[model samples]
Target chain A: MTPSTDAPHSCTRSEDELWASLGSPPDAHELQCLTCQEQRRRLAPLAQAAQEWKTGTDPEESLLEGILGRVMHGIRTEIRRGTLFTLTVTPLGPLRISSYLLLEAIRDAVDSIEHVELRTHKIIPHADDAGPISLAVSLAMQAGQDGTEVAEETRRTIAARFAERIGMPIGTINVTVEDVFQ
Target chain B: MSGPEKPDQQQLGNLVARAQSGDPRAFEKILTYHQRGLLRFCTSMLVVPGDAEDVLQEVYLTAWRQLSTLHAPEALGTWLYRIARHRCIDHLRKRTPQPRDLQGPESLAGDIAASDDRSGENPESNAETNAAMTDLRRFVHELPANQRECWVLKEIHDLSYADISAIVSEPIATVRGRISRARTTLAERMRPWK
Candidate 1:
């Protein structure tokens, strides 16, 4: 009897393998098999639809602009609320004052001093209740202005403003005369 | 599947770094880069465009707050998709239970028509194609969430199986299975058109 010469009638690969192969061309077996070819044909529209869905449509410009507005508003709100450490008052409830506002107040006070320019202000929160809040303020004094006098006057003005406006007492104000500009 | 290509890795990394360090402009860049894809992802999962936009709003807000928790800057796309998916699912869960048809094709078609009109597209010219798309949209919306998401991330977005797996929090094998099943169901439904 002649040896059996016919190839196997069915694809050896599982359905999962066939589906995974969808990204690439079908192999020889799949090309020859009517069943796999039919399946591939059915899957073609889906791939085409996917391509069409992506290329044919775009997000509404209004939607994009709206999202940008919302995100920016959110970030601003976050910054306004995020930089402060709440100070708990004994009799009153919690008082929330942002470090940014505090810096602005300090700048206003320093700017009022004659021939003194406010460079920057930083709040150094006390590690413990043993010390009150401290501020480091940098000022550029005019060439003829007395450095010591301007520093002292700016320090007192900021402290008084913090007490008057912020209802918070300051332990110390460190004035750094950064430069003497003409 | 080849979905939308991500922004270049190093560029995205720099954006993420700047955003993490409290640069709002950098963060806005990130949001703008991902917004459209995330919006489409949300719309595919939710019925209302407004609701989808709402979810995206929340997603970006939460991302801003929790950006520091993110370990990988390059993975922002997947992270954003995951957030959008969770928010969309939550939005769905909170809606009062109603018959699915209450939010069906008629409304979606109306949305399509209105959107087309606004965009100056001649819906009359593409009536047949629009009708077919409406039917396909309805069929897709009817699918279970897992299958629908799998299909969206896979075919529609052209994301790889591994990327879909990460976004959906499923094994690669599971992702492939969901996509295959979804394709089969959609193919069966689309046969009439064919």
Candidate 2:
């Protein structure tokens, strides 16, 4: 018997429908139709190959280590060129710090708190030289922990750390519990 | 080869949020989790291992730089795949169009065979497996780029039609049509294997 082409021949169901039927159990019409059954049998190998390809382990898994190294190196270099923010005005020049540094400090402060994990934090510095900075932090609290208490504690910790690091008052610290983790 | 176990949705969300906040470790974690799948996708799209690696690197770097732009944390996997697809297209466009260079059936087949760990299997069985895989890859490579993209996204990557539509920036109907067309082509071409 000749192999079926992609076009529908005399059968009412198109070849595409036959191919799709291979994915599921045959319906009543499909069970009764010789054309559909033959087409499906021919299409079975391709379907099986696709399934194997999806579930099989990647051949290039070994290259991931090298790729990761290269990618992380690129990211770190970019991180080093961090955005510079003016911390305060000095006698001769403005005291500036990299946003990377500020973020790291905030991360450390958040990490020091128990039962609370920092998801994201944004520091909005005031436009003027010596105005209060606004801090927004999203956190994930440990399951069964008090979210309100954790948020309050996280806010106080970040506030104290920010005051010590920059000697500036914090304006409205927003601490939102974005997730709960075990 | 078996892929790594993916993190749960909540864990993935947490990682994305942390990465957005300039956490290098979190970003690296996210990248590592997705590396194998993305690399396979790039390899299929580019057909050149070196070029695939370059595009994969660009995908990660772009994702990291634009991490803030990704508002939906749960969509990171699809988002990364989209970046990869774009990068692969750009890379292919920049190449000096050589039809011969586009075909790399042996490359993927060799990689799979080399990495095959069925040590206890008989040599004849292994060879048959390799031959079948080579044929499969060749038939897939013979597909038109658009059909190949849709087919690979649907079959190999196991993406839904909607997700494939989002990645390819086409309508769901279009994506479905392309995949169906691809299936028909492959079904006809791979009849001997059946």
Candidate 3:
């Protein structure tokens, strides 16, 4: 007979030999030592019982959902606490814009990113002084009824534009996709 | 599973970036991705469903609040597990009705924590196994407290002996001994299923 898929935690051997030892094998000095045989004999039922206990308990669906909800809600609550925005000035800066306009655009862009809980994470410059700064953007997206990829692209696009309009050239535009999600 | 695996690194990385910068949605995605393993570890270690859930929430909240502290993005699984283990231990300590000790010395009292001495055998004696399971659960609970805990952490949870030793602040030998005896006594008590 083919061996059963499940194994006793103790046996650590083949079934054929396990019972074979029951008939003929080594003695206390040879193998299958008397105590080992007796121990195996004793442990047979408990191992079976453990397998049942392991399979018996099913994870709670509602409990898992509730835990996930609490975690996600906690993150959202942290996001809403305050707005932390990053500003990137490119080599191709318009150079003559009022500082007020620049700040306003950035603030507005920050709002746009956070509106959907996505935002400008890092500003990666291509060179020591690359023109149109390369923006390394991170978007924390919440997948809505809208498809996940669609939401991600939308967030990425919004972040890219915001980086461009912040009165600076954004080069090497790259999105460090963190989560595709939901 | 808490959330489906993203399967692609680019997507997960993007979400992580957004999360670090205050994008609540991105952080939430990460949370959903990792909740189950954390919960499972907690449930197994705590040995109580309710306490496990409570620790799960606390662990996640702490994970969020301290998210920025984690340096390795890919090591999130291991990091979260470590935190879960710590939190469960704390929760268990609070709920366990006993004095504080790292690992109580091994004694025969530890041997018979549950009872039974090798009568398990034959299909007809299966009832012995059933009773042992119930007894084993409580027996471990009645262990010298520390040895009981060390046994659970090392044997049942499949955590490393060293890890169990560190968690209980006991010597590795102590950890191994307790585990060996815990299994020994339990095995002798319920030997038919072997």
Candidate 4:
């Protein structure tokens, strides 16, 4: 593009051309021209301001912290959303619940059972094989409580809760009494 | 691209390594380090300060989830910037941004244009410079998207043309031309004040 044809006060060369030259070695005309010198002088403050602007306009600290907190919450939500299982009924509809939420429900059910402390639980879903979910739960029984009865009670409670809350039939509820609490 | 190691890059690389290894605090460090500049760039692109912060938060979230996928840790600044740029552009295209008119109190303008103390000027001259810088910043928000991006990335961040091109996904020649044109426009706009 040609420079503006405006006379002496302004450079005949376009700013684009002048800027392009600034990237390379100084031109002989640029060295001798008064207008080009003025252009350079004009650009200097802009460049300075640009550098200063980096540290100048910081967002409020609380805003940054709030954003970070939101982002972290979003990450957790995404993780929860990723592990969601879709349950299909005969003709009713499909429902979505996170595997984590399902596991928590199981833990709560088992813990509420007499003399049983739920340690951990895992839900295994075989969507490809169209198999029912397999739940394996570990629990600690009170020393006076019968292990067999408590294990049986834990299994029954988990199955009932899974059916009631998740609305999905379970293939098996494997309850293991790993520890006996005094 | 191998070169002498910059101190900041070295620090960033270490932080990125820790963040990739599941350190949330390290990730926060990375976020705080780049937030200011990214906010400026995004604010320029989206016009509204609030939108800019939202985009930056999204940028950091994406970065946190995808940190392991970033192959080159040394280019963390550019990578974060690239993400912010895309988010800002997407944000701009999706909806109308409320224009942030320069309506803040005149006394507060100097606070927003706090000097970096690099120029070693007296308080009076520095205040004047700060006021002028504030005006230039306002003019920047009024600039078209591409030119504003090119100018802010080049001037404020001191990114090389190559880096700016990669972040904005423009050719180096195009980046140069945009910056030059932007400077010309800015010169004409500021001429009256002089």
TM-score of every candidate relative to the true structure: 0.64, 0.81, 0.53, 0.56
Best by DockQ: 2
Give me candidate 1's TM-score against the actual structure: 0.64
The window of 10 residues in a row where model 3 chain A has the poorest summed lDDT is: A1-10
Looking at candidate 3 chain B, the ten consecutive residues that score lowest on lDDT are B99-108
- iRMSD (Å), candidate 1: 11.1
DockQ, all models: 0.14, 0.50, 0.22, 0.13
lDDT of 4 by residue, B7-82 (tens): 3554555556545644455666677666666666777777555777778887888788788888787778888889
What is the CAPRI rating of model 2's predicted complex?
A: medium
Cα lDDT, model 3, residue A91: 75
Q: For model 1, name the residue pairs that clash.
A: B3-B157, B3-B158
Candidate 4 docking DockQ: 0.13
lDDT (10s digit) by residue, model 4, range A106-176: 86686578776665467778666355678877776778998888888888888888788877778878878
How accurate locally is residue A85 in candidate 1, as Cα lDDT from 0 to 100?
A: 46
Stretches off by above 4 angstroms in model 1 are A1-31, A58-61, A84-182, B1-7, B101-127
B60-151 in candidate 3: lDDT tens per residue?
A: 78877777876656656556766776787788778854432222454445545424344343434547555555555545555554565555
lDDT for model 4: 0.68
Weakest 10 consecutive residues of candidate 2 chain A by summed lDDT:
A1-10
